[model samples]
Target: MKIKLKSGIDGLLFGMREKDVKELYGNPSRSYKDDEDNTIYLYNDKKLRLTFYADEGFRLGYIIASHPDTELSGTKIIGQEWPALEAQLQQNGLKAFEHETFDSVDNYFNEDNWTIFQVEFGTVVRVEVGAIINAKDEFDWKFK
Candidate 1:
């Protein structure tokens, strides 16, 4: 499945309604209310998680795709080596900035509204795509 930046994943658009998501992806494996009182749907089999903002008519606010089969610009983001993924992002005109925490390293692609988390020294375990709201100076961290 090809992932679209700041827009959607596969055929799922960011502004789509909650019912639309369930219709396309089937019922979520589980659902939970977020801190903001919005609903979050998880499709564990597909390794996909979607967050909806109730205030915005339950529109899709975030998409987190962790399946290795999920591709962006023909590049498989999950399970990709860090260096190769970084190179791919650069070649695609997306700037990658590194953020290191106590446990893992995260690479943020600001323009693409995506963040890649490193599982190890070289492997990527997760990819978060959404409308990043807390972009502080050169670092883009929060996904809204």
Candidate 2:
């Protein structure tokens, strides 16, 4: 899948319904409400997770890509070390403006559209992209 900042992965844009997903990728491997009561669709074969919240019109709000082949600007995300990831970000004209490290895990977040990368043991474990929730805690559907 290709990551599109402030937009979506590939053709699955924000504010799309579940049926749109089903039409594009068939049925999910698993679907359920998460701990926070947000709906979740796990596509195991694609190593992706989709999250939707009722308050957001139940539209697709987040995407978690864990597949090593997941590409962003022609660079693979998962399994990339921080240095490599940083380089990829720079090369793509994207930036990780904030970062934190805890318990040997590194987290990097892009301020633009909230693409987060979680790295463990020196390699990226997963990358998460989501719609922009503004400072007032309102969904910035303008990005759609």
Candidate 3:
């Protein structure tokens, strides 16, 4: 399925209610509470991770995708090489800003939106979409 990375993914926008997620995904493969006390819903078979903030009434905070089939702007981002993905994103008029990573991984985040691509050995393995607070502090910031 084509997932939009505009403000969220697959109609699951940030700030959405947790019950909405359960209704859409029909129960996650696994669920757990994180260190921050947020409940994380994991659909490993679907390659999706959804996090809801406890303080915000369990509203959706982040949507993560690691599936090879997930597409962004008509391009399959997960298995794409760094150069190819970079070119595709640029062609789509999306500006990518490189994020610091301790390991041998290359991370690029879109300046215009909450889209992040995690590349290892030149191939993208993960993509994250969420709000800036969740993206920066909760997700990508740990890499820096």
Candidate 4:
């Protein structure tokens, strides 16, 4: 589930909490405040920034995932459980994705034999991809 997102300065302006911002992003390399009482978190390497107000609701004033001055990279999905993830994506009406097959699908799966399926969501978007077990496995499971 790896996908790239659009980056714009206006995309940064929003109302959200500092903790919520932290939860969405891992952590900030630096933090500061402004005259308007907005708390700012900056993650330079990731090209992300979040600003929140101190008042109740901690209104998120701005969020700059990537500056207009730079190019942004897609999000990476690693250490994810592929099978369940694929199902979840399907459930989300993400059928917008297209599918592709690997030439040696079975070999990459580390299985005795396998069939692979992949779903693509536009360009550089999160897609669901997985493998299928043959009738033999299904038969064995039914018997068990």
Candidate that scores best on TM-score:
2
> Which 10 successive residues of model 2 have the least lDDT summed?
135-144
45-137 in candidate 3: lDDT tens per residue?
889999888876787867888988888888888888888878878888886676767498877877567678888998898988776555445
Q: Which scores higher on TM-score, 2 or 4?
A: 2
lDDT of 1 by residue, 1-144 (tens): 787776678888777777888889889999999999999999999999898887766778778888879888888888888778878877897775756654556555454465545446568877777754445632222222
- Provide TM-scores for the models: 0.81, 0.87, 0.84, 0.35
lDDT of each: 0.74, 0.83, 0.77, 0.39
Local error of candidate 2 at 143, Å?
9.5
Candidate that would win on lDDT: 2
Runs in model 4 deviating more than 4 A are 1-13, 65-144
Model 3 vs. true fold: TM:
0.84
RMSD, one per candidate, in order: 5.0, 2.3, 5.7, 17.8
The ten-residue window of minimal lDDT in model 1 covers 135-144
Q: Write the per-residue lDDT of candidate 2 for residues 1-144, one digit (tens) a residue.
A: 888877778777777778888999999999999887888999999998998877677889899999878888888888888787788788777764588999988888887868898999989999999987778987765334
lDDT of 4 by residue, 1-144 (tens): 122121112223244456655676657899998787768788786655555656534655334432323322231332224455445545743334334444522111212212122222312212111122346752111111
